[model samples]
Target: MDRETRYEDSHVSIGSFVLESGEELPHVELAYERVGPSDAPVILVCHALTGNQFTIGEDEPGWWKGLIGKGKYVDTSEFQIVTFNVLGGCNGSTGPCSINPTTGLAYQADFPFISVRDMVHSQKQALEQLGIHHLHAVIGGSLGGMQVLEWGILYPECMDHLVPLAVTPSLSAYGIAYNSISRFAITKDPEWKEGYYNLEKPPAAGLATARMIGMISYRTDDMFQKKFGRKVKGNPGESHTETTYDVESYLHYQGNKLVGRFDANSYLYLLKAMDMHDISRGRDSIAKAAKLIQPNVLAISFKGDLIYPPHELEKMFSLESMAHFYIVDTKFGHDGFLVEFDKWGPLIKQQLKETLKI
Candidate 1:
């Protein structure tokens, strides 16, 4: 738990990892960032679909710095925080963009399909190599949250608590529909060329469009109406067809920003992995799968999230005997879990202080 400031050399190769699809990766390297006291309770912080291992930065603050820092909600001074880039990510982690040992070329479309279970298994393997056999708690939001749930189900004895924010036990049909459209946006792009596009001229337009589609579902219409409304650059009646909505412009900016840094192939792989997220996929019955979860659970949902609405969480957690559920309102919808820390930070802090004593 020596302080890691988003630097390099913090990786472990879990060799010849077999994926859920019965395919094997010759080498699966995981990049991780660990922070806080070496002897303190370890808190595994899982990143979302597009996030990396930098849970807390030194020169620059990390993404969740507001609620997880030296003296933030989770209090790094008292507990260790570890974050790792998920498989199929564009970051330092071995992903679709990584060179395939067989051909010395990027995996691209040739990358084998992976599921959430595969991601959890890979992380567990890496953790074992790093000498982290046990965790005090597992926490994350969105895709990260999905991983947290998987930990509780797959390795119940390895962790004592699970804190999943703004996520459901499984991806909903509505969520899958949105992801389908986004995947279509990327795969159908003329420049995609079956994910083997030239690195210099990747599928920027398609990737951007896919991100735009995601940005739409990540928030609520109520938030949009209040934040954007009918506002336009110039006069509203100047040119009806040409007047661009503020929301439309915002989405365009977000989409373009992701295109600059993220690999399209990685995005496609991660989206499919998310679509395959179900706690009971191989358990045969959801009730049987639920029986596998043994950790004390603290699940918080954003009231405005359209992707994983509060009801989805309620339906799944209702059967948990050791679960604590709370619905917090943040106008940002699904993205609220990343922002508006003030609305949900106290709930998590109280849970940790009251139960985990950290």
Candidate 2:
């Protein structure tokens, strides 16, 4: 299938900056797109892990399609929606897939390790380039939500409202363990070749396997049970030669779909960024970080989300003063925020209206 027509592409140049590993990154580029009228108040929508600027709307049905439109929850009639592929993302942004000026090839393993803070900093540069001095709201889910939290802490004066959905203040030990294993699966693949695989013959198998592992964590067991259960196929009496559990089929489809569009090296880089996310790191405490964000904060959690559970969200709320917490009771797990957009959309609209004074 042809890639969907993207929102208008734009870029910003970030000056030299030192990474957490003490590597100097000079002239980083941030690729972004904006929808609605430029005169409207800016609402920056950060995409989740493995997501792109299409978060708001795409030519195809996107994750947040229902939440953004002329008359939709985000109300393009009232707000200018800005979405960007994060700094280390594969989608039209500077990442491992981006050509390295020194070698004149994809950065691959040569890309500097990045943090969520670094991603937000690059986005800030994008916003500045666009002349968006202040934001009406910053909204996102999962890893995108992590960016929202970082924005609130790092640039509280830049935004009036913060909406972090289905996310946590930090990756849990269990979360890190699961991600590490997923990375191991990818890196161990014979085709990976330590991130130096041919561009045309990228490590498809390793990337697909990594995506399959992530699909399990993105949704709830209850959802799988309801949709697949223990039913099996593929034997002599089965329906098809490759048919197995429905969940397996689902994961396979998701994995294959991801490999078609994403780069394995970019996946590894973004995953490492997620692992490095710790709101309290180098700060006084989680509470101190929360205190710095004086905006009206909306922290939404999914009851069935094991990755970033409701309890973790509660802890994050406890660290803040103006946090309004909501648990989206659903069997969709961590992805509930994306799947149940109808329910959360209005809530987001209402909150933004109230907070932005629109």
Candidate 3:
């Protein structure tokens, strides 16, 4: 496989730090990679749930390709984009699938529980190692967007501009419930065996089910209706019936693909971290936490995104010192930030020009 086709794996050690659960992770290692020019202005790109460092256009063109390459929104010609798989991700980072240096086997269920702040701290170590004194901007969507918000709060001094797309400060009660159900589905599978299923026979059924649950929320009702709409398209003849609507096939493809690249334990870990994400926790109220953000903030949401509704984003902005907040109207729902790049690319370019003055 080409170097770019294979996942890039690199690590940076973060000296001792205590976790939210009162556990100590000494010398935590973060995994990351850089795209575009080294001397260019730095823009840290955080991926959403299940995403890795391959954030720019590659293979089939990454979800953010439209806005990130040469002469584009992020404009690699002027900005060096750094994307990292989050700390607990299965890609190249230390997660459940990683071998335990002590046990000489995959960490499995023994991997330490982590938090969003913990992930950011690890990324901070990676950035410092790369000689980035400060960032030109921090940008992300969904859970990635949550990381951007955390960056503003935890390391305000290291960032100049903050762009959080399609996300909120904390998971709503509904969101928490959704995650809980997904976790339950995974744990209930016969093959899970408390997160230590046989590697050769992983709990693919459970993981696919969990993904199906998530896909429902990540997209819009209208999109499903238009794409599926109870229409049954016959599949290739086989022993078992293989018929589905366009949307059903799409969802199944997404679910199966996730099971191939992602580990069940890592998915559970990251979901829990997202559930625990509340910027206001012990710091202040939501409004107060938002007020502490000193850098120019840009919060973007999609009109059709039911998962991170536009109103919720507005609530976050109401509490912040924002340079601008925009809702890009689209039918693409939460995934709009990735799919409707044509609309947002120019807008992002405009924002960068005004803020970076490039």
* Full ranking by TM-score: 1, 2, 3
Q: What is the C-alpha local distance difference test score of each model?
A: 0.86, 0.83, 0.80
Candidate 3 local lDDT, 175-264, one digit each (tens): 888899889989998999989888778888888889988989888889888777877666534436464567768878888898998899
| Pairs clashing within candidate 3 | none
Per-residue lDDT for 267 in model 3?
Answer: 95
Give the C-alpha miss distance for residue 227 in model 1, angstroms: 1.5
By summed lDDT, which 10 consecutive residues of candidate 1 come out lowest? 1-10
The per-prediction tally of clashing pairs is 0, 0, 0
Per-residue lDDT over 51-96 for candidate 2, one digit per residue giving the tens place of the 0 to 100 score: 8887555556556777887678888777888888998888777888
Stretches of candidate 2 exceeding 4 Å from the true structure: 1-7, 15-17, 231-233, 236-243, 355-358
Model 3 scores a C-alpha lDDT of 0.80
> Against the hidden true structure, what lDDT does model 2 obtain?
0.83
TM-score of each: 0.94, 0.93, 0.91
